[model samples]
Target chain A: MSAPLVIIAVAIAVAFVLALWSRAHKRMDLEQWAVAGRGFGALFVFLLLAGEIYTTFTFLGGSGWAYGTGGPAAYILAYGAVAYVLSYFLLPPIWRYAKARNLLSQPDFFTAQFDSRLLGALVAIVGVIALVPYLQSQMTGLGLIVQMASYGRLPEAWAIAIAMLVLALYVTLSGVHGTAWTAVLKDLAILAVVVAVGILLPARVGGLHAMFTSIAHLRPGFLQLGAKGMGVPWFISTVALTGLGFYMWPHAFGAVYTAKNERVFRRNATFLPLYQLILLFVFFAGFAAILIVPGLKNSNLALLAAVEHVFPAWAVGVIGGAGVLTAMVPGSLMLMTAGTLVAENLYRPLRPNAGAGEVQTVARVVVWLVAAVTFLFSIHSNAAIVALLLMGYNFVTQFFPSVFLCVWRRAWVTLPGAACGILVGVLLVAYFALTDHTIVAGLNSGFIALAANFVVTLLVSAATRSWDMRRTALRAADIPVHRAGEYDA
Target chain B: MSIRALALIPVLCIFVGVVFANRTYPIVLGMPFLFFYMVVCIVFTSLVMAIVYACDPANRKEE
Candidate 1:
């Protein structure tokens, strides 16, 4: 019933075969399954990153958000541009360690940076937990698209159930290569749909003038810069959460770190913003739909409504197919990252000498396990993945305070300082997010949490005064001096 | 120039163009000028990418 069983079957079948082929042929060992053997170059990395960015959130949720929030919807495009530029400054140092140490997760970087395995594990645990809601969000989105594609013939829960089964089977079989190949098709389809709609939607809206006049008449604030209903504080804080939180996604870090060279990454870091062409068009399409579907409640379906209004059934099918593939591609990548982090950082540490082949097998096994549980979670009627993602933002960001002040800034810094910083950061974020929040509206709770973290680090550092930043940070980065394994710190 | 001014130019350009189109014309191509500005943002983003890739020494390598 969901996605015209034929369409769902076709998509599921294609995703499954692709995953199996990659697992059988492309995956040679743990590195290949986890990081595609560190061989992604210009086109490959571009496509993979493309798949990463265009999620179900973009396909269905972008227009939906706009339709739902009106003026505030511009945040999608607004934050995206900001996120990439901000990450440019942040990603290089991360890449340096990932390359040298074969790091597979963000927690790995934290461990290597501070020379504290416990700190590394804390980040790893928080990241994995945070991803649970994100994964569920993707599942919910997949269900919505599948239902839309089915022409609303299937109920939402059933649609979600079917898509989950197919996604789970395909991802478990294929590994990262499976996701990359499918992403190429996924990205191509998204571009074609976005470009076609971008040119057509404005025409259907009775010219841009009428649309503007209407927005002014009915939803004046839709044109407002402040987006007062949500306010500047929420927007700025949400954008900060997205910008900083994006690079911290262990999946993205793992993928970018797997790039062939710093040049490719820097190119990607700067150039990937170029690919945001479709996102810009999407923001427009979301705005366009507002005039036509004034009574519509769901903002996520604005793109679909815009498509149905401007185009016909067959074209709509193609767009729906693109949405499903978007989920499959990135959802698979998340699984790969989650699996690798579990197997390599958490599992391998316990076993230490597990063979590459065994580690690879463990990663594959974990993928199936994680996918199954996430699918079950997705079937529920009212789970909050978006909020959970913000929660993840709070948790993952705890690393930043210690990262900036304690670990990289000085050598011989006491581990207690770093631990206290992370602890306070997490506690402040938790208190602000859940309890009688302290930080006033404009600033995000995460920012407040970070402030707490930074303050704690300074206090502890002053108390210790026993560490030298230069000596420790250099050693933490593992820059080879005279010997391969010898470290100065 | 201050960093603030350097950042303000492009942001201001976006606002000016968006305001001009919204006030002056009908939505062309089923979109308003602000919608079109988004396209401009996307294209401008690409141009920025091309420049960075071409100029950044870190991006180029010996074959």
Candidate 2:
């Protein structure tokens, strides 16, 4: 076997063994499998959240955008820092509510807050639909990394298939606990690879100044936004939308639920932006690639192509291993989150009397199912990885208004209002995305949809405000809404 | 300004100012000046977040 293949093999093997060993002696119940029993400290939570944040998106998409859009790639850096600020205030209330209410998933939070299983089911469906593209994109990145790492010997299809099977096995066996342990290794490898490639490539072509000077000469205004089409309005809107949607992902909620205390999350939010600086390295790699490896049809190939060109066999293997881990770590988390949604929210609500064990069993089965389906999509789908991810974020961001209302003390939003808001938001997203319009001069379609969602939710709530008029009184009366479909108080 | 409100400074400076300013000259540390300004904003953000954490009652509570 080639060095790249051998190194990749050893990395995957180590990840699996570490994942298994994380839960070797401990018994895992549904809670353990889902949220690691909500016992992770600040460091673990930081690592886990960081792991999920800097996925194939940062490893591949950051560089890809730096190569393709140039100035617009700055949104990636801006959004995370803004999101960390948002999260400082956002996640503590969420973590408190989830911990108090024993909510395992994002859908569970919706179900409990809104007192509607159908709403939970709707959330599950929307989340899974949104996440499939994300999962598929990860698989696509993995395939590309593997194919390039093996010097074109290993087929992309087989590489993705192998990754899918391995990911499914570990997720089924170790759950979130195992994923957390592997995150440490995955993060270390990512940091090393990104630093090496980000710095080395720039240094190769007469250093950073000479490289950008050359790029400016080659494609004038490539380094600045609005030069080639990344308008200011679009950049601001995309950054803001992405910042707001950062913590809306289902897996983000799951990771939040795993925090040991509210302080863990608050502390994490404070420091998470520093972690984002790693993408600066990734952006550097792309800037370097622009000058070094020109005329690549697929911008996504920028980083890997540059790696293959610059590094030796061993370094390529290690870098490829890191790239593959980037794919698998987040890919596995997405699969686990989507599967849990399927079994716990979608299936269980239909059969309200299903046991916890049954949900766990079904969730395990659904992990494999989700991975297989996404693997198929990755092989067959024509969507770019970045586009797929942005599409997912667009769909998921509609939940923001509902969540913002739910987490706050006022329970004014009726189930019908929330549902209608989501429907309108999703439809707007579809309209803009399908029509391929810029949503009125460079604003993100999702941002527009989100605003419409908020407006509709408020209007619908005002129109039907009397429906849940006594919700506050009902809560004050300490009545459980489960006793009655309407107002238990 | 309070630390919480001060946090918005980084967001505003990076997203709004940097985009509109759009200066490309004077590449600092091998990065475009605009991009380098973003890096400065990032470091400033971290420093601000540290202050936010230190001031937060929840983070200050003795375990």
Candidate 3:
């Protein structure tokens, strides 16, 4: 085996062992497996949330956008910081509700709050649909990284299959604990590699200053948002839409339930933006690639190609290992969350009498099942799944209005209203995504869909709301909405 | 101003300010003007949140 392949093999082995090590002496009950028994301290919660930020997408696509689309790439940085700000208020109520109710999955939040199992099932189906494509994307990204870093010594198919097996093994054995432990390794490795490449790659051509200067000379106005397609309006709307929708993903939403206390979120909100600055280095790597390795048809390969150009085989292996961990950490979390959603929300509602042990068994089985399906899609290169992945963010964003409403003192929207609203939002997203009109009238199609969803939800709630809801509303109004002492414990 | 309202400053700087800052000329700190502005806004977001966290009574340690 080549030196790079050997190093990658060792890294994957270490990550797998660490994932199993996290399961030492702990019971893998359904609660423990799904949300780490809601016992993670501030540090673990911080790492888990931060782990969501630097996925295979950020590792490659962030830089890819910088190479191909230029100024539009900065939206990645803008959305996360804004999302953190929103989370400071949004997540505390959610964590409190989930903690009180012992909720395990995102759909549980909808089910409990709205008193509708149908809504829960709807969300479960949507979450699983949105998540499978996401998982396949991670697998696809891992395949690309291993194939490139190994100099084609390792085929993408074998690489994906190996990763899927390891991910399934650890996720089934160790659950969310496995994801958290592996996240520790992933964050450190990606941080080191991003900083190293972000700095050294630029120095090869010139310094950061000289590199941007050269890019400006090569592609004038590349650093600014364009006047037509990706103009200022598109930039603003896309950033707002993504920022609002960041935490709505089922995995991200479910991750909040693992926090030990509400204050963990407040603290995370404070420092997470500082952590987001790491992407600046990622963009630096992409910009450096533009000047160093020009004329790459596949812009996603920009970062890996640049690394291969400048570094030795062993260095490429190290980066590839980091890349693989990036895929595995999130991929495991996604698979676990999807499984729990199916078993807990979808199957449990149907069986009703299923014991906790039975649910855990079903969840584990579903994890492997999802892993197998996404693996097949990744290898087959299914056109439909690829298209679904394109609108995955928009699909998840449809949940935001209902989530925001559900967390209110007494949710105003009735269950029918919430269900109908989400259905409309999702249908609009499907229409826009299928028609290939992601931007309509210079605004993100998702943003427009969300606005329409909000209007329809309100109108329907106003029509469908009954007398009991009004009574509840009146009682809720008597209590102050923002009680400073309520969450202090 | 309420601490929650104070949070809106970072939101505005990111969502609204990016429009006017979309220029490539006169690179600051080796970054294009737009990128430099975003980096500053990202740093500013943390600082603002830090202030919010410190001032909010709900975050105070209880006896």
Best by TM-score: 2
Candidate 1: where is the Cα deviation over 4 Å? A1-4, A26-52, A151-153, A207-209, A225-229, A305-311, A353-365, A372-391, A404-414, A430-440, A461-489, B1-63
Candidate 3: tens digits of C-alpha lDDT, residues A264-364: 78977988897787788889999999988999876777889999999998899999888889888878888888888889888887886789989988999
Off by over 4 Å in 2: A27-53, A408-412, A437-440, A470-489, B1-3, B56-63
| Comparison by lDDT, 1 against 3, better one | 3
Shift of residue A251 alpha carbon in model 1, Å: 1.2
DockQ of predictions, in order shown: 0.29, 0.66, 0.75
- Model 1: lDDT equals 0.63
Error of 2 at A272 (Å): 2.2
Q: Model 2, residue A464: displacement in angstroms? A: 0.7
The order by descending DockQ is 3, 2, 1
Report how far residue A477 has shifted in candidate 3, in Å.
Answer: 23
Backbone clashes per model, in order?
Answer: 20, 0, 0
**TM-score against native, each model:** 0.78, 0.89, 0.88
Would you list the C-alpha lDDT of every candidate in the order shown? 0.63, 0.79, 0.80
Clashing pairs in 2: none
Largest DockQ belongs to which candidate? 3
What is the two-chain DockQ of model 3? Answer: 0.75
Interface C-alpha root-mean-square deviation, candidates in order: 4.4, 1.5, 1.4
